[model samples]
Target chain A: MQATPALTVEHLTKRFGGRVAVDDVSFTVAAGEVFGFLGPNGAGKTTTVRMLGTLISPTSGSAIVAGLPLSPANGVAIRQQIAVMPEAPGLYLRLTVTENLEFFAGLYRIRDRARIPAALEAVGLQGRATDLCGNLSKGLRQRVALARALLNDPAVLFLDEPTSGLDPVASREVHGLIDGLRERGVTVFLTTHRLEEAERLCDRVAILNTTLRTIGRTDDLRDRLFRKRLLVETRAPLTDPGSVFDGSPGVTGWEANGSGVYEIVVTDAKLAAPDVARALVAAGADVLSLAEQRHSLEDVYLELISEDVEATR
Target chain B: MSGERIRAVVQKELRDFRRNRFLVGTMAVLPLVFLVSPMITLLQIPASTPVSVIHHAVGGSSLLLFVVPAVIPPIMAAYSVIGERDQGTLEPFLTTPIEREELLLAKAIAVFLPSVTVAYGIYFAFALTIRFAAAHAVSAAVWHTPQIVAQLVFTPLIATWAVWVGIAMSVRARDVRVAQQLATLASLPAIGITALITFRVVTPSVRLAVALAVVLLVIDIRAWRFVSKLFDRERLITGSRAKPS
Candidate 1:
């Protein structure tokens, strides 16, 4: 039998007064999956995390987090099964790293003294456990927060903007730690505005702009929102581009983009490439390069957000 | 409800307080400042002074000591929740499994322990000084059984009231300074009642002191429950209340 998903949010909505922060947001994250929640500022990504983390109740709809129904009654049980690290590291600045983790361990009611050191080790901060949190750099503090989240050995970990303000080096350190979490098969629900971070780290990402704009694997989203295409670069422009490409198999249309470059719209790049290439040779054209075009997650995100902006206008 | 969680919060709070220069300075300075007036009042009492004058001086001195527990704790307690919010820690702290009641009680206990300790310590030091260093009549007036009992009984009760008031203000106020100022202002009423006992508006007797202690205890317990309800996680996290489903 398949294992139950780590998170099941159905029509989860949160409104503050007349403003709807998160509207009808629903998605499921499979066990051991690293799911990214991406959005712009005030896009309700944090609010949705707050709801699933049980820090706040939803205005409407429901969710099952870590196998427990999301309700006030199950808040403690659900919290016990999951961990949330907000954007701020939130470590008590005066306490030593070990003291911070020890305090959280006590709250988790974990009798084993081993988890503290283990968590510290997991973040590669074992050597710095004796240092005060205030004395640590921003990167090290973020690691300590990650260690605190790991103390309970939670079933799901929710990280909201885990690397919001860090420099490149610090951000890279955090990215590496997240990659390690993925290796351990931990179910991680990451919320971030950095598109590249989501693209590199998430198995699937959901983009939200108050409501969920789109959600799926990055590749799948690219495929869903953009048509398949091939970019052809040649030594010379086709003397008759339409005659060379009009009857080609799988070739829907073609556009001359630049000097000796043709952007061919295709049903399938694989099926169309051979036919188009053969036709080009017959037309006495010199083909420099031929490859399928690729679109980054950023393209898909911008496309959806621009559509929303236009609709609003 | 978990003791471990409560202990964790209390432990973290105390550790944080110890390092906080403002809190340490407030805890140390307020007791000494409140103590000085009482100590001077008791010390200046000459053996030749009238009985009534000595009684008035000692009663007034004793009343001033109540200010320590009442005023000092509000500053600390008021900082508790709002301080967490100011430092961007409240969200992560609330995300834990600890209940609001446990968090408030632990914060109260953390504030209560030090405030009550300083209040009692100052009172004891004052009483001992009066006993060994002051005039016989003044010392006797200060050492009266009902007075000593009232001091012991009401100090924690008063501190408890101040703690709850501060926490309530912390929960509701948008700014830390505003919360602390309001909490201090709100806590004066607890001391005002004690002042009535000092001035004989409410007679000073063991029976009356005990009865008043009971009343304050009930109010403190009820205040804790009310503050627990006032602690809206949704409001704290989002700066707005969660709409009802």
Candidate 2:
């Protein structure tokens, strides 16, 4: 049996003055799934997060966050069940780390006195609990903010650019903490402009450019956007390569990318790789290597955003 | 309305205010500066002073004391909303389960406690100094029953009014300094009303003072409800209201 979705947004739109921030975008996030919301700057990623997090009301349409309808009357109830970590760490610079988390813990009214220390331990900041947030590095402050978000043990955590400006090591630490949350079966709705972060941590990702351009698993998006191709590299140019490669199983088409490099379009690389190798050997081609060409999430994101750039042009 | 949430806001605000050097400087310096004029005025009164002359001098000094509560709270309360926004903390704060009423009340109580304490402290210190140091006629004039009651009752009410004004300006002003300045300017009217009473322009009486305190109380409560309505999440977040799609 399927549990209820953690978030259900239908025709959710937000406009500021004459500009439309998020335009009629709709999506659902399943329970315990790590969903990534990827978009460029001003693509309404934060606006959507703000709408779902109950920080701002939508201009039109509706949503159900953590099993509660999104309305002014239900705003507090919805907020009680979810946590949103905005792009800014937003910590009180003068307050100690424990004080910051304790304040939020008090807001969440988490009766368990142990949760503050537990949250600090979760973020590896137990020793720095008494240190002022202003004294900590940017990375440490982000961790403290994350600990504050974890105070409620929220059912759905909406993280907006959780690793936006961190160093690679700090980013890795945060990624690990996200992994820990996933292991605990917590549903995470992460919004980021970093495609690699989404690719590494998200179960599914939605690409938005004002409106949602596409939404699917990263590999699925890659497959859906570009055709599968096997890259063949030979030591030297081959004579009569067409005859050698013609009628090969799973080889729909072929083209010479360079003198010794051929790009082969294949229905299935597993089926065509062995046949292509045998044909290349039979044709006396010195084959240096043959491998499937893969596309990264960056390529997919750029493809979608570039399309947006083109449509406006 | 969740006492825990209110307590949390109050705790966080007081903690922040305690550590802020500028706020501490303002809270410390303003009351002391306001106290000096009244202390000097009472010290100058002579034993040979007539009853009416002593009454006028005490009334004028009491007006200066009232300015302590009216002015100091606007400075502190003005920082409550715009300060959080200036530091980028308001968004995370609003995302919590805290209602607007709870936040406003907590902020009011936070400023109210310190402002009223300092105001009352200054008042009591002045009274004690008058009892020991001032001439007999001046000390007796300062200890008038109606005057004592007015100071006791009006300090919190005036501070409460200044707080709501300051918070209202904080909600609307884009910058913290500007909010504080405007809130200070806006709260002067509360002092103006007290000035009329001190100068006997409205013919002071026990019934009149009570009626006016009730009126100030009603305004403070309405101001709370009004400021709560003015606290728009969308406007604060985006600096603009949602336009029709």
Candidate 3:
């Protein structure tokens, strides 16, 4: 039997006055999967997270978080099972790091006295446990917030722009921490503007723009949205690379580089690479190398967002 | 209501309250004046003074006692939710498992305890000062009369009413300054009515004291209900969007 999904959001929406912030957004996160929610500013990423986290009630539709259905009666239970680290670190600046964690542990009713220290250690904040959150730097404050979020050992975690405004080293530290959470079978629902971070950590991602545009595995999205490309290098200049690709079944178009290189858009690079190489050699051009080019998640994201904008317009 | 969560929020608010110099100064300085100034003025009155003068002096001191509970709660409770929002702490706090009523009550109690305590403490200090300093002139029965009932019964009720009003404003007002101003304004009606009784502008009788306490209690209940209803988690989060990022 398949395991139950940790979170299921169906047709969730939120409206502020007459303006709809999140419109009919829907998705599900499986147990222990790192699911990324990506969108531009004002695209309802935070709104959707807020609804799932039980911070705000949905204007319409429903969701189930950690087996508890999202409703007014189940808000407390849903909050108990999931933790959200908002876009801001949102730590008590005056309280010490240990105090902050202990306070939340108490709120979570985590009776284990050792859990406070364990949470601190989990976030690598044991050394700064006694330091005032106000005295700590931005990155350290984020760590404290993470420690607080882990106080309950929640089944599902919501991290919104976790690494935003962090230096490279601090961002890496957070990435490493998230990696550790995934290894421990924690379901992480992450919202971020950084495509690279999502591409690196998320098992699958859902691109949202007030509504969900697409949801699938990262590589799968790239495959579905972008065509394959193959680069061919020859020992001599391709005087007429178009001639080689003209009648090719799989080749859609070709562009010649200055000297011995040519870039070809193909229906399937894996299937077309060998054929193109054979055709180049047959055409009396010595084929130096043939390689396939993979598109990045950023490309797919930009392509989707621009398409969304154009369609809306 | 979860007792543990309420306790945690109360503890954290208290810890933060300690760090605020302005609030601490107001809590300390204002009560000091109200408590000590009455004693000083009572001490200056000669023992040879008439009974009417002594009664008038005690009545005047009782008015100062009313001021403590009225003023302190607004200063503290007004800052509770809005202060957290200003400090960028409310968002994470609301995401926790703690219920909304638990969070609001914990904050209200955190402000309520110190405000009422200081008020009553000052009243106790004033009574002691009057007993020791004006021993020959003022009778102990004067202190033990309706003023004691006012301190024990009416002060807390009024303080609670003020706190609930402050919390209501804290929930509705986006700016902490605006919340504080509104709370201060809300405390006026209660304080004004109490002042009338203390100054003999309204008759000081046990029945009047009981009647005032009952009325304040009713208002306190309504204020609590209003605060609980006004504090919308969505509004608090979305309202901050209008603030300069």
lDDT tens digits, residue span A26-48, model 1: 99999999999998899998889
lDDT of 3 at B228: 88
Give one digit per residue, the lDDT tens place, for model 3 in A212-299: 9899998889889877889888888976777888767799998887698888999888888878877888899988788998788899
lDDT of 2 by residue, A1-313 (tens): 1379999999999888768889989999999999999999999999999988877778898899999998889989999999999999999999999899888988888879799999999999999989999999999989999998899999999999999999999999999999999998889999999889999999999999989999999989989999889999998888877897776888988899988999999988888899989988888888899999999999999999999999999
lDDT of 1 by residue, B1-245 (tens): 89999998999899989999988988888789988888987898789999988888887898899988999899999989989999988888888899989999999999999999999999999999989999999989988988889899999999999999999999999999999999999998998777877777777899999899999999999999999999999888778876669
Q: Please report, in order, the local distance difference test score of every candidate based on alpha carbons.
A: 0.92, 0.90, 0.85
Better of 2 and 3 by DockQ: 2
Best by the lDDT measure: 1
True interface contacts reproduced by each model, as a fraction? 0.78, 0.76, 0.74
Q: Which stretches of candidate 2 lie over 4 Å from their true place?
A: B243-245
Scored against the true structure, residue B238 in model 3 reaches a CA lDDT of: 75
Model 3: DockQ score = 0.52
Model 1 compared with the native: what TM-score?
Answer: 0.97
DockQ of all candidate complexes: 0.79, 0.73, 0.52
Residue B39 displacement in candidate 2 (angstroms): 1.0
i-RMSD per candidate, Å? 1.0, 1.6, 5.6
